[model samples]
Target chain A: MNSIHDMGGMHGFGRVEREVNEPVFHAPWEGRVMALYRALGFLQFWTIDGGRAAIESLPPQTYLTASYYARWLMGLERSLARSGIVGADEIAAGRSLRPARSHPHIMTASDVANLQRGNFERPTASPARFKPGERVRTLNLNPETHTRLPRYARDKEGLVEAVHGCHVFPDTAAIGAGENPQWLYTVVFTGRQLWGADADPTLSVSIEAFEPYLAPV
Target chain B: MGDDHKHDHEHPDHSQLGEMQARVRALESILTEKGYVDRSTLDLIVDTYETKVGPRNGARIVARSWTDPEFKARLLSDATAAANSLGFPNPVGAHLIAVENTPQTHNLVVCTLCSCYPWEVLGLPPVWYKSAPYRSRAVIEPRAVLAEFGVELPENTRIRVWDSTAETRFLVLPMRPPGTEGWSEQRLADLVTRDSMIGAGLVRGP
Candidate 1:
């Protein structure tokens, strides 16, 4: 989805403020929210991609107005509601109305180590469709759903620098779709290519792109 | 660096307990009461990133790379192994890639979709890194963004913006300062700022 979260190029948000000696979290609640978010991710309630999709699902006004952890909180609620772990009413009501349903895949403290070593890389039967140095153009698509392809790079031509091994496709996996592992590539584009001739000519940008989003130019 | 001096800031002291904070506390209390989340475990998770793991881990790696040529070679080639060799464990979904800043080119990292940082090394991301302005402007006008951060490069230097779109996370091996040739690793590590590793600032001279 071409949501506001994909704010790659559009401007006028004002100056970037830096906090001196910033802590891991701003507020105590922020930490708790983060911990809960991580806990949800650990339980595999939703893929990281799906979580991102949930955040992007926020309406423009809410997205711009909410704090960082607020987005995380909202996204977590969206995923939990979609997964039937808890509903919006229960969330606002501050307690479960009925007995909790059992989930087989609960993650506990003992599983933290195993979770750390887990890898997202998966094997693929099909060979890569693109190689290094091949010129390609990003497929321009604006689906109203989860996607990893950024809006700025869509339809822009770039050179494949390297073909990363097959990995789970996030666009589909985010929404309860299968892993759908596909070829990933590091594509390099001049800033001019992505922006315009007025952009810094010497500047270049590289992005990791899924095979489905690219085509040989 | 001048910009930083001009932008005199205090530590992120979130002292004022706003309505948002109250709501968050309420949510936490509810989740804890529900048995869905354990408060102690939650604190442990947060503490791991807040105190135990953070930019200091990345600073150690950056310091080593600056002093050791072989480690630098290994880091630029295969960052994961190089990092693990220095006791930097791989985070669950991270694949580290070190992009060195050279005389002619500069590198910066941003996740346009989400704040996908190398948590094992750099800990949780800063607030601005995840904000809309940084995410949008970092790719579009990196020079201006860097300027706002007080990082000014020569006109001829080209900026290479790396958008972390997938699992492959990147860390910028900022150039070793000119006068720090014989500095010890610990001394060098002290000079390594979090923003330098993120390509938003330079290592200050001793």
Candidate 2:
């Protein structure tokens, strides 16, 4: 999905606004929204990729206008309705009208205390196709489903700086497909290659490209 | 157009803020009623990010790297393991990669696709980090972005922009400022600002 969310190199946006002494959460509800997002992870209703995809699926207007957490709130609603955990009508009415669905896991205070990040690395029998210092070109892919390949890096040539081993492929993991693990690499592209000859000579861009997104140049 | 300054905040409109509050409240109540999430757990999650986990964790890591050569090597070699050794684990399905700033090169981190940050170490990302301007221009015009953040590197210094497009997260290890040779690790940690670690600003000399 080449949505507004894939904003890397597109212009017309103004200068970056830096807030002084910014609070973690602007409002109490902001904190609550974040908490809900974290807590719902225990349910395993959606993958992290799926959650991101939901946010990306937002209308371009809504995606551009909504705040960060507000986007999360909207994405949460979208996921909840899609998963049948909650319905749009129930959300609009501010109450639960349907019978509560049972989840295998419900986050408790104890679960919160012992929370740790999920590890995505998996064992693979196949060797990596590309090695460090190898020249590769990113595939020009424009999939409608969730994809980690940003529009800016599509069809760009880069050098593999490091091999990140086998990890869950987001393109599959995002859309309820299995975690088709792929070898990830740190591909470095010159600013001139990504943008144009007018780009700064002193600048370079590196992205983590899954093996599927790359081919030997 | 006149209300451009309002773009500084995530939620600028009062009505929109109120609507978000109500929507979040409604969602929370529904989830609780459905027995999917407990209120106490939600409270604990918020408290953890608010009080415990944050840039202080990353700051300690940076300060340790500055003081301890062996630890710095480990951080540069295997950042995920080094972060976990300091009790700052990477977020779900993510790896931590610490890029060092030197006399000739600088590193900046961004997720142009989404706001994929190392939450365990840095906590939630700031609003500007997830903003469109920073996301769109950070990779293409990093020197300009750095200038906005008051970080003007020498013209000869190379800028390496890490767009965290996968499960990898980047932390910029700013060069230790001079004139603080004998400073305590704690004192050095005090100089590690979030912006410096994000490569948007330089660690100021005391």
Candidate 3:
């Protein structure tokens, strides 16, 4: 989706302010929200890609105004409500309306360490379609739903730098379209190719593109 | 509106903050009551990232690479295994690739689509790294962004920005500062800041 969150090339947001000594969470609520967001992942209601897409799907106004964790809280709420785990009134009234639905054994203390660190790669029987040093072009896609393809690199020509093994594709997985695993490649696009004549000739940008997004140039 | 009424206008700000805090508290309690989350375990995870695990892990790796040629070779060639060899397993989606910053080339990293950082190695990302400004401008004007972070490269040096569109996270192996030939790993690690490894800043002179 071409949302506000696809902030690859647009500008004028101002300087990157550096804090002298930054804490992990600026406020106590930030910590709680972060924990809730992570804890919700244990339910397997949505993929990590889904969580991100929810955040990206926020209204442009909310995306611009909300704090970092506020965005996380919103995404969590969205996932919960959409999945039927929690109702809208329950969230608004600050209480669960009914007995908790039976879930995959509620993640225990012992399970916290290994959560989300498991292998996301899905085995593929086919060999890679493109090899290193091969020229390829990114598909110019503009979808209305969740997509990992940033707007900046759409339709750009690049060289395959390296081929990573097949992994769960986020473009489909985020929207409940299945893993749709595909070969991933590190494609190198010159700055000029991406940004045009004003860009430095020697500079380059490498993007990890899914197989479906690329084609022989 | 009078001078003495300025405080009245600020009252809503405090109430708004209080409401947000109440909302977060409410959500936490509901999740706890439903058995979806354990408060203590959640605290444990947050505390681990807050205090125990951080850029220090990545710093040590960078310092070791700076001092050991064999380790550096492994780091550049195969970073995931190199990280594992040093007791730092590549976590989850983080298939790290260490890009060396030479006198001629510089490297910068950004996840334009999302904030996909190497959490196991570099720990939780900083607020700025996850900010809208950094995400938008890092790829569009990396030199300008780096300049704001106080990193200024020569005009002739090429800047390579790695947009982490997938699981392969990048770590910038910033060039060793001049006059640090025999520095111990411990001392070398001190010079490597979190930003240096992220390619936003350079290692300061010791």
Candidate 4:
């Protein structure tokens, strides 16, 4: 249990607190690469116009397949070709491809960072905070947007026996919400605490939690 | 490396994406039918990572620390081994250091590096966690960031920021929320939020 909570407290590369005005940290080519990838991928998690604009803004590159989205598409095309299934080129040649059918590009590390950093904006403050040792309940539902609680962790309860300092809310960042939420918490729960017969009586699983996902039990 | 995803058609119809998804879906369906990828197993993977992994892991650890002092000491000393005892796997040689989120101080997490996370316990990290701004800015201006999320800390509370990297990770032992006295562990897991585990949020009131 301690180990799991400790996992949440992960911090390395801790020394560089603020970005320096160094060229190495960010380069113009980096932005161009991002734009090229976005164009090739047809970015998702964004509106259609936004996606179009991103693609149009891309810097020139000789090959589309080299870009992130194009690479993924290349995989799909191969799968279709191998399966002896319907082909994308036929549809494209016919000019009958639907916008809704397009899959958004799988965001790369750099692209994910760029999108979250520039576009997202957060609210002024947190709506609530649980105190140390207070009781709380985690929500069971799943929202496609960003959330900290995984499906396996749901409906399991633990004591908010300890509080870690605040960090950015993952949900906000996931949906271009920018940084949100301040504190992350560790709740103590036993194995029998979650699965009765399936779990070892003496064994347990500790979970790291965020505030918004939890409610008083 | 490959360019087969595109269709080389005789006419300029331009309906490539629709055909692409349909083809992909068809392949997925075939794989599921052929038993290459078990549907239930994939669903379970998605389910476990999305839910069962986060705050519950944190809570159990905190309980152990509060109840068993020796185990707590061992956990503090060598986190990976301590976690492995509970059937957790550590691939990154992740050395964990647990920070007790107490009334006076709160411990938080961010990856100043790539989105290094404790997947053994927390499962795959949420998409937001892997972002650059969250990784880069989390350590520098934690207070303002917290405020934006609706969590405003008392100025006196000491803020301990954890930087997640490939070599090490951190988890928060959230201070319990108030209300019920005798709720079972299963009941408690209900309140453990992914945010709480990272030190961004406290369990909300029911």
Which pairs in model 1 have colliding backbones? none
Model 1 scores a TM of: 0.93
Clashes of each: 0, 0, 0, 126
Better of 1 and 3 by TM-score: 3
Q: What is the number of residue pairs that collide in model 4? A: 126
Residue-level lDDT tens digits of model 4 in A72-169? 33433343333333246532343222223334343344332222112221333654478778777667756544354544456767667555555556
Assess the local accuracy of residue B139 in candidate 1 as a C-alpha lDDT between 0 and 100: 91
What lDDT is reached at residue A21 by model 3?
84
Which regions of candidate 4 deviate over 4 angstroms? A1-217, B1-55, B63-71, B87-94, B178-187, B204-206
lDDT of 4 by residue, B1-206 (tens): 11122212211133654454454344444433433334444443334334444445655555454445677677776665666565532232335656667778777777543355665555545534543335444544566556655678876676666554222467676776677456665566666676777776776646
Model 3, residue B80: C-alpha shift (Å): 2.4
Residues A1-217, candidate 3, lDDT per residue (tens digit)? 9998898888667777666788888777777787777778867889988888889999987876777777888988888888887877899989988778777776666665554354566788799999999999999999988877788999999999998899889889899999889999999888889899998676788888999999898
Better by TM-score, candidate 3 or 2: 2
Misplaced by over 4 Å in model 2 are B1-13, B88-94
Model 1 C-alpha lDDT per residue in residues B62-127, reported as the tens digit of each score: 999988899999988888788888764334344678999999999999998889888777878888
For candidate 3, lDDT tens digit of each residue in B65-169? 999999999999988778778764324333678999999999999888778887777888887788777888888788889889988899989888999888777
What's model 1's lDDT at B174? Answer: 92
Question: Top model by DockQ, which number?
Answer: 2
Report fnat for all candidates as fractions from 0 to 1: 0.57, 0.81, 0.62, 0.00
Highest TM-score among the candidates is held by which one? 2
Which residue pairs show backbone clashes in model 3? none
What ranges in model 3 sit over 4 Å off? A113-116, B1-13, B88-94
Could you arrange the candidates by TM-score from highest to lowest?
2, 3, 1, 4
In candidate 2 chain B, where is summed lDDT lowest over 10 consecutive residues?
Answer: B1-10
